[model samples]
Structures are given as structure tokens and as C-alpha cells.
Target: MKNTLLLLFSLFFYTMSLNAQFQKATAPVADKKEHWRNIHDDKVLDNYYWMYDYFGKGPDSTKVVDYLKAENAYLDATMSETKAFQTDLFTEMKARIKEKDESVPVFKNGYYYYSRTEDGKQYYKYCRKKGTLDAKEEILLDVDQLAEGHSYYAATGFEVSEDNKLMAYGVDLVSRRQYIIYVKNLETGEILKDAILNTEGDPCWANDNKTIFYTSKNPVTLLSEKIQRHTLGTEPSTDVLVYEEKDKSNYIGVGKSKNNKYIFIVSNATMSSEWRMIDASKPNDSFRMFQPRMKDVLYDVTPLADKFLIRTNKDGAKNFKLMECPLGKTEAANWKEVIPVRKDVLLQGVEEFKDFIVINERKDGLVKLRIRSLKDKAEHYLDFGEPAYAANFGANPEYNSTNLRYSYTSLTTPSSVYDYQMVTKVKTLKKQQEVLGGYNSTDYVTERLYATAKDGTKVPISLVYKKGIKKDGNAPLLLYGYGSYGASMDASFTSTRLSLLNRGFVYAIAHIRGGQEMGRQWYEDGKLMKKINTFTDFIDCGKFLVAEKYTSTKHLYAMGGSAGGLLMGAVANMAPDLWHGIIAQVPFVDVVNTMLDESIPLTTNEFDEWGNPKNKDAYFYMKSYSPYENVEKKKYPNMLVTTGLHDSQVQYFEPSKWVAKLRDMKTDQNILLLHTNMEYGHGGASGRFDYLKDVALNFAFLFTLEGISK
Candidate 1:
């Protein structure tokens, strides 16, 4: 016992010596190479522009790599003290999840399809049962086995042929979002030779079973530019180019109707959409244009038995409305309003069934599922019974069935799946996420609060904490925000979040603008020239939390990813003192520079969302808040910035350059760590359990700042 104590004491001293060495180590200093650009008479200088040379394999490629490695090494040395804590957090969070779990099976076609994970596995196996739920199980794809040797592997677009004899799926080993479609003979258990590369990973199978359609992407820009149709057993080079999008700004894809009667080629931009349709049975026939692209009218067609239902923002329907047209008359002039535009409700989408239709509506930042009878036009909504919860349609593939599968969850409730009878209004709980190690909803408390923005707009904030926790200023709180692309940040439940709640941390989600939570106008008011509202909304929420005694400025932490990372960068620049620490994951921080480069992936496609910077007005507006451009010599909060080496959406150089500049300029000697995953992309690790490690590191960063060590 005395020797054990002596050994522990020696180990402690060794660790302390390493910590002291890391503290004395110098941070990596990025070289300053002058690069200037002038747009609309505005000239600017960029010192870190050379970081973008990595992808081009230019002279500075090795230098960029060496610099990134140095920063990573610096981060390792600085955070070496928290290494064991991060692993402990990972194990703690992973323990709450069921090792072997299966999804609730969904009845589709002639089989009940589901995916199940195995013990100690990082991926799942796709399985199905014939006819009845008790029938013999057939394994379609064992993703675990397929991903065995690959460091990063993603299998998506699982499209089974209408006959159920074959399956077509896309695989991405590079983690760049570019997938290669492969065909597998499910009945014979044989993999086919048909492989198509550089696709968007969306494989749409035609009714004939011998043909498939997929959207092809540009190799360099990674833009979905062409829809190609390939025949079974034929070389991919011989694939027919069915449709090619001329407008670089519009993103295009090919899909089939849920009823399997028609194949569609959809081209959509931020403000407009166009669609073309061809009979699924007639794969060789030319596609007929249902509607030509309009200036600002965005619409989508849902095929009904006798007519086509068009959900559109036509005729100034800001919140959108449902319009119907006769089977043969699909022109805009022939369309008649079935559901009028509501000022309070936003018609998010619709799911079509033979006898009924489900309308997904959002009002007051909450999702509402309204069932309408196609035969009688009667309508009713499914009750979720929670003020701040996320409810949405699940996998309801059978167009002839009356049952609607929907999922519901709140900040406190576990994700629950339910199948509701549209005719009888009866709902059956299919499954709720099994949080291993036990979890009780009553032990937690959730609240939906509104924080007034600087412009007087009421931004919604959803928060959750332990039941016994007091609303005092001493608690540590993490405020998460993602206000971009009209994607609503709903209050959803995750078992891993319990770790934070159990650790006396309050978690809050800021439903800021640039999202369609409130309404379409809410999004319009927060994007383009008004993009400042998103940053200010997040800052206001942080301040509001402090004012309400949920947390104080000293304990407040902020986190965001992708576009939300842009938010993190903005808020840090605009209001640094509001947060003690910040986490920006795969952040789109170099906005003006990224927007000006059309060759970059997603740059040309997001012109309407972020604005085209070539124009004089937009050039100035974007530069004003562009994180990397606006960074100045000032005190800033401790920040942990993460990026993937091969991120297709937002390049890794953005975060790398941003961090280098922050290190060079920031006055405060706060922790500024940059973690670049050398093997992953925008969405980090592909394995189910592997992502938890990153989460653990993030939580450890926050815990270290809060001085909470386990």
C-alpha cells in the first residue's frame, strides 16, 4: 500500500512536469504572405490566404500541412492535462447508450425494414422481414463489415428495387460527400459490377428495376450539375445524361414519387425551384416540364391520385400555401388554392396518402402535424402535448396505408416514435429511445423562453436542466445556436446531453432568425443585409439567460457548427465578454472570401442565402460581419475551433486561417485551441460511437474552463 501511494505520487509529479513543459512551449506562428484582392473598388489584404493552397497541391501545400500539424501539436501540448478527462467523459456518455439496439421497423412495400447495431460495433446492419414482423430476417447490408478497414466510411441512399430483389446504395470512403453508387443483388446475395462515381449519393430507382437515376456532381467544385440515368450491367461512362442544370446557383437532384408512378428532376435555389416529371414505367421517355423556373417562387409538387398538389410561395404567400392542379393542367395559371396562406402558420411540407394527406405546419416555432382527408377535406392535428418539443413525420412510405408514423421529442423527453391512425385518430407508441443506465424524464425540467432581440424581435430559447438545480447565477450554461438556411433548431433530446445536466450544466438552444422557426418572414429578416440579427440574437439570448439568473456571464459558454460556427465567430467579435468560452465546429468563418470564390463547393449555391459578394452592396455587407475579415486586436473569450481536413462545405483553411489570425491579434491570453481531424470531413467521424469522442473533448473543454474536474 505504501509503495502504491509512492508510485501514484511519482505519476502526479510526472504529469505536472509535462503540464509545465507544455505551458512553456511556444504556440505556432503562421507566416504572413501578402495577398491582396479588390472587389467593387474595395481592396483588402489577406496574410493567411496561402492556407488555401493545400487543395491545389501548389508550392505552399507542404507548408500548409506542416503549419496545421504544428497547431495540432500545440493544442495537444496545451490540453494534455484534459486527455484522461476527455476519455472518461467519452466512456461516461457511451455508457448511457444501448450497445446493441435496433430501430423501430417500418412497413414498406412487402417488408418491414430496420437497422440494428451490434455490441462493440461502430456501425449497423440493414435488415428486413418478409410480410409479417415475425418472419425470417434478411440482412441486406452489413455496414459494420463494409466499413471494417476504412478509417471513415459512410453508406447512404439505400434504395431497394420495387421488386425487392435488388438494392442500390452509395458509399463514400473519402468523407468528401462524393459517393459511389453500387448495385447489390439482394436475392442472390451477389454484388454487381455497376459502379458510378462522383455522385450526390441519391440513387432513385425507376419502376422497371433495370434502370436507375442519380445526380452527378462536378469533380472539383462538388456541385450537383447533371442527372444521369444508368442501365443495369452497362458501363457508367455510357450513362445517359438526362438533365443538366445551366444555372450554377441552383442545386439539382433526381427522385421518384412515393407512389412509384413518376420520376422527377428537381432544380432548386434559395428563392426559386423548377421540376420536370416522367412516368416511372416509361424510363426511356423524355421528361416533361411541370413548371419553368420562376424568379422568386419556390414550389414542390406532391402527386395525388387524381391531381397534383403544389406547395408554393406563389402570389406573395410568404408562409407558403397548398395549391392543386388537374392531372393534365400543371401550369401556374391552372393551379387553384386548396389551402390559403395563413399569416400565423407556415406550411412546411406535406405527405401524400391515397385517402388522406398530412400537412406539416409550424406556428410559434413549434411543429404541428395536421391530417386532412382527401375525400372529405376534413382536417385534424396530432397532439404532441408539449410546449417546446420537436415532432415530425417518420418513415411513412406506404402511400395506401392510413397509418402515419411520426417522431416526437423534447428537451426532457426521450425520442419517441408513434404510429397514428389518420381515420380513427388513435396513436400507438411504437418505441422510445432506450437510454441504458436508466433515465427518467421527470428528473429534468425544460422551459421555453423568449428573449427580445435588439430589434425587438422575440427570439425563442429552449433550455433544459436538472430538476433540483436552482435558477442561480452560479450555474454553468451552454447556449447553442444555428441560425441559417431556414433550418429550424428544434428542442430535441439526446441521451449524451444527460452528462452535462448531471454535471450542473444548463443546456439551451437559441432559435434565432435565419431559420424558419417563427415564419418565412423570420428567415428573411435575419439573412443577407440583416444577417447581423442572427449574431445579435444569440448575444441577446446569452445576456437574457444571465439576466434571468439561469447563468452568469462568467459561466456562460457558446457552441455552434457549420453556419452556426459563423454565428459563433460573429458573436465572439461583436460581444466577446458575454461568453467565457466558445466552440466553433467546422465553422464557415471566412464568409466574404468564400462567397467571392465561385469555384469553391457550396459557394455558388448559397448566393441567395448569403448573397453574391460581387455586387457592391453585398460585398460590403458580408465583409462587415465575415468572421476572419472582422477579427481585430481585442480581448476575446477562450475558444476551441474544430475543422475537418477534407470538409467539402466549408474548407478547412477557413478555420485554420481564422485561428492563426486570432492567435496573432487577440489581446487576452485565454485558451485558443484548434483541432483538425486529418481523416474526416465537415461531419466528423462517420462511425456511430466515434463522434462521441469529439463531443467528449468539447465537454471537457467546457468543464476545464468551469474548473469542474472529475
Candidate 2:
């Protein structure tokens, strides 16, 4: 016992020595400007606004790049002490993955399609077999070959023609989300001469198979604003503009119906949607409007036998409901209710087939699939035994089949895919993701808990930890939250997270407002003017857990990315002393400024999700909560901020300027580091295993603060 105490004492001294050495190195400094602006009779100063460079290679980009490089160097110098440990973490996490695994084949038309990863490849190979999975594998496109010479690569909108002879795909070589559409003659193994640039990545195929409808992005704002028609043999410059969205706030998209009977163009904003339909057989015919756009009336059209199924939010159905209309009369007044809305149920979406209809609904913050037999109209819900889990429809391309494919997972369960007979109600497990190393689902435990907010509202929290770990406040905990855009962060299992659980770390997600966890009202109560509730809810969750002996402030850590990154920034400012460290990834910190600038990608389209800062009330309200605008000269916890230079969603300038200002005004000597990925964008690295390197880096930062460095 004496020797053990001496060993721990010696290790603590060594760690302290490393911290002292790191603190001596000079931190990167940024030049500040006295730029003042007036808005709604208010004056504000933005010192680091000079970092705004959309292209990342503008005339002033040199200084911007240099400052970023210096920050990267400082991070390297400070984190150098954990270089070996980070590498080991990366290797450890990567080993849990099955390197040569293949996804379960999804059957479409005459082929069974799937993607396979090679033992050492960085990208996947899309392959298919005709008739059955036992047939010879036919490679559609080797993404590994396409990504060979690029630093970043992503392929999207992978769709096959109705005839199964052509593959339409989109590629983005630079980590920006701008994808260029391409068509390949699969039989000849040759890419065609057609190439359309800057698309939203979803291609709609006409029944003729030679004509395609795709949405194009605006050059300046990067919003999907135009729908274009391209024939297989036509010149790229001669593509016809079929439709265009004049409203800047509306995003446009095109899709083929599930039955491949009709093509559609949908224009949607936050609370409104308008759809136009085209007969699939007549490729040259113009599309006709199914419904006119109405404010606060959202709906989606699904092609049915003699009528159209519309999932709409009309008639005060805040949680949405299903309605039907004649094929020739799709106007709102002519619609008939197919499924009534329930206050406690959130009707997410629907999948139509000749023999069955699947409704995806959320209740009590959990997802379930309701399968109804079209013949007898008998409905049944799939049972997931866990208190919290995710279940939804998989790719069921055929409209005449009785077998339904679905996926299910939870915090402790591996992703499992099954094919169930809707009529017989028999389910067969097709595949479950394999973890290479020895793993057991029963080894960990997940629980559902609620934390009461200041307003007396109960916020749900999903927690997972190693089995048999004592809830004694001594264990380190990582809390995560992202509450924006009505996006629900479901309880999904991940193999990489096992690394933390095995090392005595508890992970929890605070499902706060601004997400659709508890239905439409949950999201309604936490956005725009009520955005503070999302942040405060997360804070309350942390306080509740600590008070309950789950963890204390000394060992608590916070993490989030993008809008959630905004959450991290808010919590840090609101309760700086509550966390030992915080990691913000590609955070949208400059909310007020970013919203005021309409040229940015998020400004025009998300004006409803966020408010239009041009309004005086919104200007002052957002100004009060914007993270970058509210940074004060006070002590803060250790922070590690990361962003990519080529980010298309939240610009790199946001986080870059944020960290610079924090360094200038922060009073604490606590370690603050910024990492700028020069080769990636908003989503980070494109390689299969390369993104794990960042995860390992983040874990290393947390482990170091807890003095767990090896």
C-alpha cells in the first residue's frame, strides 16, 4: 500500500511538470480591429470580423491562414505530451470495427444492393448481385478509386435508373457540401459525358430512364433554388430549367415516387411546403401543382393507387396527421382525413406499399413503426424491449411486397436489421453490425432519467455506463446536448464509445427542448425567443446529475458540435465553473452576425428556426444570447475548439473568430486550444477510419484533464 501511494504521488508530480512546461509556451495572438456597427439603435464592436473569408483563399486569406496555422501549432505543442496516448486511443477504437464487413443487401428492382469495405481501404465499394445475394457481385463504382488522389471525398445521391442499367451519383471532392452529379453506364463500366455541377444530391428518374430531374444550388447562398431536367445524351449546357423557387427562404428538392409512377418537385420552408407533380411516363410534360403554398401549413405527398396520401399539419394538428386526396383533385379542401392527429403522438412520416403502410411515430421520446396490412387494414406496432430505442423503416423500394425491412438499435444494442412479414408478423434478423473485438451488449447498462427545469418542465436524459459502476460522484462524466432545428438525437449504440465506458466514464445525453423528442410542442417551446430554455435545460441536467451523486463539477465534461456547439458555448459562459473541460466542434457561435448576413448558407433558409435579426425585437433578443457577442473577461474551463477550413454549413470564420476573441478576453490560464483541419470541411475527414483520429484527440483532451495520461 505504501509503494502504491508513492507511485501515484510520483505520477501526479510528472503530470504537473508537463502542465507547467506546456503553460510556458507562447499562445497564438490575433490582431484586433475597432470595427463598430449600428443596428436598431444599438452599437456593437466586432474585433475579429476580418477573419471572414468564404473561399478560404481570398486576397486576405494569407493572414487568415497564417493565424490559423499558429493556433494549430500551439495546439500541437500543448498536446504533444499526449501524442503517444492519442495514437493508442485511435488504434484501440479502430480495432473494435470489423474492417472487412459489408452492409446487409437492400433489394431494389431485380438487384440486391450493398456496400462493402475492404480490410485496409479508406472508402467503400458499392456492389450488387442480380436476383439473389448468392449471385456474382457486380461493382457499380469503387469509391476507393474515385477518392484515391483527393484529401477529402464524399459521394451522395446514389441512385439507379429504373431499367437498372445506369447509375446516377454525386461527388464532392473538397469537403464542401456542393456535389456534382454524374451518370455512368454500368454495363459498359464507363461514365457518360453528362456532368451537372452544384446540386442538392438527390436525382429523380423518369420512367423513361433517360430523363432525370435534379435540384441545383444557388452559387452565393448555397441554397437549393432550381430544379433542372437533363436527358442522358444531352449537352450539359442545354439542360432545361424545369422549375425555380423565388422565395429565398424555401429549399427545393425533386424525387421519384416510391412506386416510380410519378416525379415530384417540393419547395419547403420552415412551416410551409408546396409540391408539383409530373407524370413519369410522359418525360417531356411540365409539372402541375398538387397544392399551393400556405403559411404555417406543411404537407408531404405520397403517390397512391387512385388517390394521393398527404401528411399535413393543417386543422391545428401540431403533431401532424395523414390526409388523402383524389389523384386529379389534390387541393386542400378536397382532402379527406386518413389518420387523425393525437396530442401525445408525433406522426413523423409514412411509407406506402401495395400490401402494407408503415407509419413512423414518436411517443414518449421513442420511435416505433406501425405496420398496417392494406388488405385487412390491421395495424401492429413493433416492440422494442428497452425503455429507450430507435426503430424505423429501411429501404423498401418495391410497392407490392409483404415483407417489410426495418432497423432497430439502442444505447446498449448493436444495430440490427430485420425483415418482417406484414401479414404473418414473423421477423427474421438479417444482419447485426459486428464488433471485431470481444463485445457483449449485457456488459453495459442504459437508463432513462428526467431532470426538472427551472420552469418545472421535465427534460429527458439518456445515460450509459459500464455495468456495476458505482454512482459515487468520483467517476468522470461527459454530458452532451444539441437542441435546434427540431432534430432529435436518438439513443443509438456506437462501438467507438465503448472505449470511454470501459475506462470508467459515464456518458449522458440531455434531450432538451428545441428537439422533437416530446412532440411538436417540445420544439415550439425551445426555439427563437425561447432558445434560452435549451441551454438552461442542459445546465439543470448537469446540476441534477451532480446532486444525485452521478458526478461532480470537478470531473464533469461537456461536448457538442455545430448548433450543439452553440449549446456548449452558452453553457460555458453561463456556468464556466461547472465543467472541467469543453470541446466544441464546428460551432455556430456568431449567431447574431451570421443571421444578419443573408449571404451565408444558413441565414435565408433558417430565418424561421432562428429569427430574422433584421427585426428590432429579434436583434436585441439574439444579441443577448449570441455566444461570441457575450464573451466576458472571466475565468473559463479548459477548451478545445475544432473547425474545418472548407466548411460549407457553418463557415470556418465563425469558430476561428470566436476562439481568437476568447483568447484575448479570457482571464483564466486554463488550457485553451484550437484545431483547424486544413484538409477537411464541416463533417471532417472523409476516410472511413480517419475521422476516428479526431475522436481520439477529443478523448485524449478529456483524459488529460482528469490526469489519466499514460
Candidate 3:
């Protein structure tokens, strides 16, 4: 009887231990809600005094107002101090890296170039070469002046004629609904003609240089149609209907051949694509579709003189293989493998010259430029051992045959432009950029950690901090991620993040599923019906951080924007206890509603990524985790939700409705701030300084929650 009593006592102890673990994971939600309420109430009183002091009148204002302002200022100062203290503590524990490098890449040119400003401004800068690796800039056009009448000045590709007489560039003024093909005189820099075209098209230079070929929407169905031979001085001509995409699934575009005999137009509907050959000799000739018999083929085809190089996944491998086929005779059976797929490597693009073809490939996360001899099939690889993410190789305009330039960059590294000689295989560094002051990469380190998810899947988490940091639970941890659309969240340097790091916070990237980090299969597994894996993986990462004592739940903050915002929404809803605060910018929270309506823009195109909600199973799956639909009566953490009024992708209404729903359903009176930019598109904060301010506010909120200063 005594032994039995001892056995019962052992069982009771085990159950208590499990319960304690559960409570430890969930105790932060109540504490966070209480803290947020206190902060919000105090801030309200502080804001009242600040407003009264700024606008109040009379001679006695100096006396009473000064006292009130001083008291208010004290509170504000205390909040700021609290944030700083928390930041410093995190910095001490995590060894935060917040150094900026002076050497980076800058655009060097003499002409005024139009580019997008951080504050959603269409600004033009006159680029002048100062010396080798140095350039001067002057403002040419201000977006604020032009942004009044027009929504935005979206700049696309620009092309100048061989004689430098005329220049042409494409611009999508608003939401890609109206595209304008603008032609300009190079000498005067005045727009000669701004021809409006349908959505989904790019301008292609004709052989005659005076005329251009492009595609646009059909007036009847408003579907994509091909238009050719539109000259500068002629009247509006009839569009040659190359390929009519019946369903909304197909995409159409025109490509000019090197020989200029046949115009290659591709039609892609769903995952499969068909190349149609159009006879340039006869403008009215019918287009014949060249269908290839390959399963799961994904490619972008570029034409050469005699043969066309196809950048595609024709082989049963993860990477793309370059296949060579004769022009106008490219069929499934006619394709000959020119470059075989290497393990853990992908060939990106190919640029052909007279005797050789230059192929860009990524091996072991590093980019290499390979030259393949067309005559002897010999391959020569150029070794550029840098953490380069994306690269573009261009032949010099002065000596197109001899000199080539390649531009590359990584996360921590700025862009570098190098000029290479094909014959000599020697590279000359042309330019390096200087970003800003007070940043150094050597002071910090970036490391990858794998954590087990709810399903035992290993999720890769990237941590960036100062060296020799202790594994303490006191650090203010900011975890960021975007897990969707097979997009890999590559490591890249950011100047704005230095402010948070310097304040003593631990920054992390959780590479959950729905991204292409592990491979294509990883993305496929996480998307569609398996989308719950993304939220679970992120939660697992948070749990692992707490379990390892890297950070506590009370000091952890989560962030995501755009599609990543969707990630933020899901995770916040699933495990609000694990996060002190969340920042969701332009999130797609109404997934079931958005995907169900085919009338919405780009809805059909995304059906492959997120399954069609018409099916009952898909509807159930999407509705189950939809953030807007799943706001149960529960205490939510402090959240800052932002969106742009001009955002075309995830419309502002989604966030507006989401904030409303969250406010209605939330039990705790937590601060749910919704900041909407009136002029910006999907990206908020148009200016660099404005962006910095927004980031500072976000960090300030997180720091306040950690009780750093107070």
C-alpha cells in the first residue's frame, strides 16, 4: 500500500512539470496586454499636454503650460529611457552588430535618371562621373510636383537608338492598368510621344529603329493581345492578334529575333508555355504554336542568330538546363541539351555573341560567369568568390565584342561593378559604393540555426548579432520572415536595421516553409493545403528561442510585410502568447474572400500558389486560418498595422477591415495602431528619412514593452 501511494505521487509530479512548461509558454500574453494598456493610457495623457502646450494661448501659458509640458516631457523621456535601457541590456546580452560600411556601389552616369524614392516619389537625378569609383548627383525632377495630378510615375526599361538620337521608356502610371510608351528626343530630353497601351506589355525596338513592337489588351475582352509595327509618325493601326488567351490563365509577350526574320511570341497559361513563330516578312500571317512535350516545364526563351537558347527545367532536375534549338523550329523533339543541370546549382540566363555564349549560373550560393564556345563546345568559368545574390552581365557599347561588365552584391556587401576582358580573363574593379557612416560588418556575425518544428521538420533560422554574446533570455529579439510564393529570403544588408541593432536587440530571420530555401519540394509542401506548416514553423522557431534561453516571450517581437505580412498575421493569431508585439504591413488577411472572387485583379494567376477557393476543401483550408475571419474573442498583443492608400496589390480595404474586426473581437484594450500613407503604393514611406523615422517608431514600441528604461 505504501509502494502504491509512492507511484501515485510520481505520476502527480510528472503532470505538474508538464503543466508548468505549458504555463511558461503562455504566461506572457496576460502580462503583455497589461503592460500595453498601461503604456497606451500614459501616452494619451502625455499627448494631451503636448498638444495644449503647442496651441494654448495667453501670457500665463509660459507658467502653467511649461509645468504641464515638463511633466509630460518627463513621462515621454521616461518611456524613451526605458526603451534605451532594454536595448542596451539586449545589446549587452546579444552583442548586437550595428556598424555601417562606407564602401558600397553607386550609380555612375552623366544623364538624369528617373528612379523610385523610398517615400514613393518619382525623382530624377543627374549622375556625373567625378573620378574612378566616385560619382556626383543633382536632382532633376521632383515627384511631389508631378504626384499631384498623376497617381505615380512608374518607370520601366529605357532604350536609346544606335545614333543616340531618340530614347524610349515604358511607364505604368497606376496599378499597371494604363501603360504609356514614351518616346523622347535625347538632345532635348523632351517626351515626343506618350502612347497609351493596354496592361501587360513591354516595348521592343524594331530593326528600322523608328518603329517599335509591343503587346496590349484587346478592346473587347480586355485580354492580352499582340500589336506590332507601330511607327512614330503613322496613324493608329490594327493590332495583329498573335495569340488570343481565352481564359485568364495565359500570358502573352513579343520577342524580336536576332535575324529579324520571325518574331517570337510566347503564350503561357498555367505552368506550361507555348512559343509561337510569327513571320515578320508577312505582318498578317498566322502564328503557329510550337508545343514542347515536357512535364512541369518552366522557362524564359531568348533568341540568337541561328539557334535559340532556352532557359528552362526540361531535365528531371532541380536546376534549369540550357537547351539549344534552331530558330522557328523549336519543338520538344528538336531541343538539344547544351548545358546539363548540376546538383545544388541553377543556370539563370544566357547572352549569346558571335562565337560564344555567356551563361550565368549559381553554384553553392555563389554566382559564376561561364563562357561556352559555340564552335568547339568548350566551357570556361570565371571565378568571382563573393556572396553575390543576383548578377547582370552586359557587353560594353563602345567595344561590344571585347569588354564586358558584371554587377553583383550580397546581403552584408554592397554592389560592385567589374569590367572583364573576355580574351585575357582579367577583371578590373570599376566602382564600389559608400552607403553611410557608423556601420561595420566585422563587429557582428551572421549564423544559421536549425530548429525542429511541430512536425519535426528542421526550420533554418538566421541570427545576426555581435560576437561573444551570451545565451540569455533578457535580449530584445526581433524575428523577421517572409514565407510564400517560393521566394527565398536571401541574406542582404540593410542600413536602417543598424539603428535597432545598435540599441541592443537581437535580429533573426526564420526561414520557414513556403520559401525556396530547402528546394522546390519544400515550397510545394508548405503552400496550398499544407499552408499551415508556415505558421507552425514560425511558432516552433519562437518556442525554440525561448527553450534555448536566447530570448524570453516577454521581449520577443515579430515583423513581416506584404506576403510576409500574411505570415505575420497567421503566426500572431496562432501564438499571440509568444510575441510581445507584431507589425503587419499590407497583409493579405482576407485570404478566403480574396481568393474566392475571380473578378479581383491577379486572382486567377495566384490560384496555383493558393488553391482555388471554389473547391470546398480549399475554401475550408483558407478560411480556417484567415486572419480577418479568425479574430476570436481573445486578448491580442500590441500591433501596428500599416497600408498604403494607393496600394494595388493588397488593397487598403483589407487592412482597414482587419483592424476593425480585430478591435471588435479583442477583449483586452491593447494598442492597435493603423497608419495609412495617402500617396504611396504597396511600399510605404517614400523618403529615406521618413522610412528611418517609421523604423524608429517601431523599435521604440518594442523597446517600451521590454521595460528597458522604466
CA lDDT scores, all candidates in order: 0.93, 0.89, 0.62
Residue-level lDDT of model 3, residues 378-461, one tens digit each, is: 778877554324456743333125456777654455566777677677888876544544456677666667899978888888
> What TM-score does each of the candidates earn?
0.97, 0.97, 0.74
**Candidate 2 residue lDDT tens string, 1-710:** 99999999996785474354343568989998677868898999998878884353455778898899999999998888788989999999899888898998888898999999999899999999999888999999899999988989899888998899999999988877888899999999999988989887787788888998899888778989899999989987799999989999888899988888888989998889999988888879999999999889999998878788899999799999999988899899999998999999999999899877899999999997898876787888988789978788888888878888999988888899999888788999999988878999889889999999999999999999998888889889999999998999889989989988888899999999999999999998889889999999999999999998889887889999999999999998999989978999999999999998888885799888889999998888888888899899999888999999888888889899989989999998788989999989899999989999999989988888877775
| Candidate 1: tens digits of C-alpha lDDT, residues 89-125 | 9999899888899999988899999999999999999
Model 3 has an lDDT value of: 0.62
**How does candidate 1 fare on TM-score?**
0.97
Error of 3 at 698 (Å): 3.6
In the order shown, what is each candidate's alpha-carbon RMSD?
5.4, 3.3, 11.6
lDDT computed for candidate 1: 0.93
Q: For residue 383, what is the lDDT in candidate 2?
A: 82
Native-to-model Cα distance after best TM-score fit, residue 73 in candidate 2, in Å: 0.6
Off by over 4 Å in 1: 1-24
Show how many residue pairs clash in every candidate, following the order shown: 0, 0, 24
True lDDT of residue 658, candidate 2: 89
List ranges where model 3 is wrong by over 4 Å: 1-122, 126-151, 172-177, 197-201, 215-229, 234-243, 255-264, 277-295, 315-318, 341-343, 351-404, 420-423, 467-469, 685-697, 706-710
